[model samples]
Target: MTTLFYRKIYAMKTADSTEFYVVRHGQTAANLQARIQGQQDTLLDETGELQVNCLAEFLKDAKFDIVYVSDLKRTRATAAAIMQYHPDTPVFFTPELREWHLGALEGRSFAELNAAYPLLMQQIRQSSFDAAPPEGESMLQFQERINRFMEKIASEHPNQKILLVTHGGVLQRIFNLAVGVVGSGNLRPLCHNASLSVFQRRNAQWQLAVWNNTSFMHLTSANDTITL
Candidate 1:
C-alpha cells in the first residue's frame, strides 16, 4: 500500500462553510455476487437498506445545506434514506456521478471476465487513467465527467455543507484530483457501505479532510454489519 501524507496548511472550517461529505451507497445484489455493475442499474438489498437507515439515524441531528446524488437507483435509494432526516434539504440528481463504465464486462462476474479475457483484465489492472475497456469509456472520460460534477458542486454551493451520494469510483477520482494524487495507476480501495468522507475548500484550494470514515456505524445497531 502507498503511504499518503498531507500538510495541514489551514485549520478545519466550521460546519457552515462549504464542506463536502461523500457517501458510497450500500451493497447491491451485483456487489454481493462480485460482478462488475458499470452502468447497469442495480437495486440495494435488505442489508443495504438497513445500512442506509443506520446512516440516516447518524445524520438525523446534523444539518446540511444541500444534497446531491447519482441518478442510479442505488445512489438514489441511499439519498432517499438520508432525506428522511433532512427532508427540507434540496436533492439534486446527476448521471455524472455514476460508476466507471466497465463496458463489455458489465454484469459479468469477475471470475468469468478474467477467465474469458485474461489479457484485457491484466491490461486494465496495470493501465493508467487513459486505459479503456472494450467498447467502454476511458479513464480520461470518467475523470472529465467527475471534474465537471465537482465544478458544478463547488460553484453552486460555495459556502454550504453539501452531501453527495455517489459511487465508489466517483469518490476515488474526486479524492485523487482534489489532493494532486493523480495517475497513481490504481484507485483507492473501495468505500464501505454508508461510509462518510469529508472534503473542505480553503482560500480557493480543496483538501481532503477525511477519507473512508466509518465512524457513522456507531449510530447503528450494535449487531449491524454492512456487507457491501
Candidate 2:
C-alpha cells in the first residue's frame, strides 16, 4: 500500500455536526482471486462477514444519524453488520456510491487485462482518469457522478454524523474531493477492505483528516483488511 499520508485522529466537541466515516466494503471472493468486481453483485465471503463483524464491534459506541451504502451486496452486507450496532441509524442506497463499472473487464484478472490492453492499462494503472473498459463509464462520466454525490452529501448533511459503506473506487473519490482535486489525475488514497477513513467539515471545508485507518480492530483480525 502507498504510505502517502499518516493518520491523525481528529476530535471535536460532541456538538460538532459535520463528521462522517467512509468505510470500504469487506473482502469478496473475487478480491481474493485478484479479479475486478466492478459493480458486480458479489456476496461477501466468510472472511468478509468476519471482518465487518469485528469492525461493527469496534464502532459499537459510535453514533451516526444516517448511513449510506452502495447498491451492491458486499457493501450492503458490510453496512448491515455495522447497522447492528446503530439500530436507529437509517440506511440509504444509491448507485452513485457503487464501484467503477468495469463492463467487459468486470471479472478479468489484472494480469489478463494487462496482456490484453497493454497500453491502455499501463496509462491508467496509476490513475484511472481516462480509460474506458469496453462498455464502462468514461473518466469524465465517473467524475461527474461522484462530484454530484459529494455535493449532495456536503449540502444535505451539515453538522451531522453519518457513515458511508461503499467500494474502494468511491472512497478514492472522497479523498480526491477532500483535497479539491476531484478528477485531475489518478490521485486517490489506498483504501483497505473494511478499513475506516474519516473526514470533517470544518470552516465550511472538507478535510481528509484520516486515510485508510483500521486501528479500531484487533491486530490479528485486522490483518485480513490490509493489502500487500
Highest-TM-score candidate: 2
lDDT scores for all predictions?
0.77, 0.78
Which model scores highest in lDDT? 2
Candidate 2 has its poorest 10 consecutive residues by lDDT at 1-10
| Candidate 2 local lDDT, 110-159, one digit each (tens) | 89999998976775565667777788886657767787887788679877
Model 2, position 143, has a per-residue lDDT of 66
- Quote the positional error of residue 22 for candidate 1 in Å: 0.5
- For candidate 1, give the lDDT: 0.77
Candidate 1 global Cα RMSD = 3.7
Q: After superposition, how far is residue 58 of candidate 2 from its true place, in Å?
A: 1.2
Cα lDDT tens digits, model 1, 88-155, are 88888988789998898899998999899887777566536756788889877887888887877787
Candidate 2 local distance difference test against the native: 0.78
Model 1, 179: alpha-carbon shift in Å?
2.0
